[model samples]
Target chain A: MKKTLFEKIWERHIVDTLPDGTTQLYIDRLYCHEVTSPQAFAGLRERGLKPFRPGRITCVPDHNVPTLNQDKPIEDPVSRKQVDTLEKNATDFGLAYYGLQHPRNGIVHVVGPENGLTLPGMTIVCGDSHTSTHGALGAIAFGIGTSEVEMTLATQCIMQRKPRTMRITLDGQLRAGVTAKDIALYIIARMTTGGATGYFVEYAGEAIRQATMEERLTICNLSIEMGARGGMIAPDAVTFEYLKGRAFAPRGAEWEKARVAWQNLYSDEGAVFDKEVHFCAEDIDPMVTYGTNPGMGIGIREAIPSLDSIDEAGRISFLKALDYMGFRPGEPMLGKPVDYVFLGSCTNGRIEDFRAFASIVKGRRKASGLTAWLVPGSRQVEQQIRAEGIDAILTEAGFALRQPGCSACLAMNDDKVPAGRYAVSTSNRNFEGRQGPGARTILAGPLVAAAAAVTGKITDPRTL
Target chain B: MRNTFTILTSTCVPLPLENVDTDQIIPARFLKATTREGFGDNLFRDWRYDESGHPRPGFVLNQPTYKGDILVAGKNFGSGSSREHAAWAITGYGFRAVVSSFFADIFKNNSMNNGLLPVVVSPEFLSELFASIEADAGTQLTIDLPAQTLTNQATGRSEHFDINAYKKDCLVNGLDDIDYLLANKEKIERYESLVTSYKLQVTSK
Candidate 1:
């Protein structure tokens, strides 16, 4: 039988299968961050175990580190302690450590690909849901819990029951203002957040192939939002080009050999998928989430669904979400005032995203009523923003660029939006208080966020 | 010792909201700990307490009339973030199992890894389970791990749930993946030697 890209990577990494039906999947790369690794390291210490392959592991402190003041100690005592724990753990384990203020220090997912640590035809695991972002290079990457983290550290292999496969083919070209983020939100809205559970998705067709590597990463990063095990697009010229000449990527003859292996990473011509779904990219619109979950989204010009549109079983929760957002069921979301704007996360924190945001706010001044936090994904992205003069344009538009970290995405640092205030965010997830305790977040693409920062409300980017 | 899960009979606390994500289970601010203890006190922290740090009497967890070892929630529970902290919070708050019509993939794995059972029932069955709890807080549900069945004592309705055979065995035996992997170290090494290496090792830029 022919095999899919996921199966190709998965089968190659299988070490063994137990009588109880669990396969031991070997992981080529394991990324760790401060928030989740401390406990795992503590477990290793208690068990008197060491990392089986320390060279394959990489660590960074991003979740709790502040986006400002790289030179000063973290003011939040608890946050500082966790960052300290990770540094100590990495040092004791002899792993590559990227502590706060290191040039490579950033969100674990962002730095992996940008630094060329993520590669095609490999199995990657991280203690973060956005680890799926690495699958854009045709790798099998997914999130695992800390117990699995300890397992990987002790053995470099994790037990798993394989998931079913899905193929989501996005055909044709996207509309003028519709972006990769919009397409992601569109798919999640259609899938209703749980539709893809128990499946590993493979994104294919013209639209997916046409997307830039950064755009592809954004698409795969949201695979978890719809409950997928992970998502991937087979490596092509775009993937190879994105990895070429990067700091950690292979050079010369080794690069040529690696490219040849990556070229065969696609699904065979007659490959079979357990399920398949199709969509036209032109059907997607600039989307904005109106309620608590990522699935509660609509086209920018649309109104929030009325009570009658919701099924009786879900109406209570639906109404509760609207109430938390301070939105009525029938209210139009377009002109709803936005008090804050956040422009960074693993999902939309790439250089392309910064370019898109700058495209909209180049000449226009930011709304005086809104407080905007424009952060880069990594120090490299920050340096690029300056080299490309994007920072000057943002400053000229009255927006300041903050240092790199996973700031405001989960509000672990001081970049939180105050309670009950509305924020137009380019980051993923709008769960209640995700941006801050009781802070209302409207999830959107970079262009939509830029539009909101200028108008101080949820404005359609196309209209602006 | 508490890792072994076999049989449980307990009443349930009903959270009739869909997409109850991990962030709501435990907010990001409280994840600064270096260890796993004391998370239960802050489970559902924002919802259980007000800005003034007082209990919200209206929340299901804070109500005196409802007390249980099970959490019966609406569909699509634990939908965001791969934080096992969410599972830690649930287990810490005294829930051995979470029942819903659906669950996110990573959360389900995390729950089972921590010996917290995730029971998936039909949509109608979950709704009825919530209704039974709302009608009377003392209603009990029995989960038989070996049989893979969940029974509602109030209505005497039963449903079969699915779990990975290996995970179920590990949970029943109070075993974990690390133990199994540690035992099979030689197999892992042999397999690694036979495979063609695709890894690009770089110590620094």
Candidate 2:
């Protein structure tokens, strides 16, 4: 049978079919971070079970680690306890652990692909929604609950029913200054948050094929926001080029063989998906969210939708979201004042993201009223910033680089936007209080965030 | 870890807001704890309490007049993070089931795995549920897993819901992923050997 990329990888990992009609899927790699793994480890301990294959698992501490002062102990007792517990659990299980301050330590999703731990045709599981980020490498990856995390740890497998497949095809070229982040936001806004529920999406067409691996990762990282089980891009020459010299990637002869296999990873010509949607890439703009949900976004130059534009069932929540965001219908979002600008997350915290931010703020100074947190996705990315002189440009422009961690994205650590303040963030979700208690977050790309940092308010990057 | 759910009938607490994300269900600050047991105290912590830890008077969970084991929330409940802690918080706060017009895929899966039912209904039926509960605080509903049906005892209204047959079976038997996988150990071993042979053939060539 002709199959899509998702089905190809998924079928290769099936261990057995249970009487209950769910597939027992074998997991090739399992990534764990401090915030979600402690309970899974505790469950394992309660059952007196050790990891089925310790070598298959990798652990890190990111969400709860402070982005500043890595040398000192975490001052927040709760954060300190979570970090300490992950280290202890890793030690007890005899698994590879990249604890805070360790060179390998970084955001779990970033660490996976950069280290070549994420390979094509593999089944990856993590207790993080951003696990879909690894799908850029042509893997079947998705998030699991803590119980599934424990199940993967004890058996190196998970039970899953097959998800229907959807193909999202983007054609045409994206205009200059528009980015992968904008593409994601634009798609989510049109599709709404629950549009892709119960489906695994395979992103295709010319625009997706032309995107850089980093850009593809940014796109796939937001799959969960649209309620897709996961999203994948087939491995092609670009995918092989990105993996060629990485640490955990196959060696010379093995690489040649693996490349040959990966070449066959695309969807068959006659393959049929359960559903299909197509969009012209030209329609996407520098997007930003005006309301609490990520789906409540509009083009940077467009006005917020009027109440009459929304359906009766949605009018109430639409108004409520506007109230929380301090926005009004028919008002342009371009000149709204911003108190903070956050330019990091699994979605856009990569080196490419920093370069984009630096390009915009090279000679301009950061606005005095604005406070910006520029964090790298990994220590490797931080080092690259210095090597490439992006660090100096940012510092001269009145911004400092923070250590690599999941900072301010969800306010798990000390980096939090004050309540009632407006922050133009490059993170994925802009749900209510996602940054901090009562903190208002406006989701945008790095270009928009950089523009906000320089102007101290929401301003179209094209205008700047 | 809790009771095996076959049929559950209870009054409900209503949160009429749409897109109640995981962060709002249980904020990220509360996620740092090593144990899952205490999350119940902080469930809806920001909305439930002020900065000084005082209960906010306007919150539904805070109102003494409303109490139940089921939470009838607005559309798209649990739409943000993949934190299973959200499910822990809901279950810990004594909710056996959450009824919504829709649920974020991961949250629904997480709820089921943790012995919490995520009962999805039609949007119109969901609104009727909200209206019924608002009219009388004592409105009761019964969820029958075996029959895959939900009935409003107050208004004599009923709705059919869909759940994965595998999940329903697991929930009714109280069998987790580990338990079921362990039961199929021999089949899994056979499959592993087949995969190993296939790999050996490719590498040898």
**Best-performing candidate as measured by lDDT:** 1
Clashing pairs in 2: none
In order, the first chain's TM-score in every candidate is: 0.99, 0.99
- lDDT over C-alpha atoms for residue A460 of model 1: 85
Summarize candidate 1's per-residue lDDT along B15-67 as a digit string, tens digits: 99888899999999988888888899999999999999999999998898888
Question: Reference contacts recovered by each candidate, as fractions?
Answer: 0.74, 0.62
Residue B59 error for model 2, in Å?
A: 1.7
* Chain B global fold similarity (TM-score) for predicted model 2 against the true chain B: 0.92
Tens digit of per-residue lDDT, candidate 2, span A141-200: 999989899999988888898999999999999999999999999988988988887899
Model 1 residue A221 CA deviation (Å) reads 0.6
**Please, what is the TM-score per model?**
0.98, 0.97
Interface CA root-mean-square deviation for model 2: 5.3
Which window of 10 residues has the lowest lDDT sum in candidate 1 chain A?
Answer: A98-107
Per residue, candidate 1 scores C-alpha lDDT tens digits across A124-184 of: 9999998999999899999998888888888999999889999999999998988899999
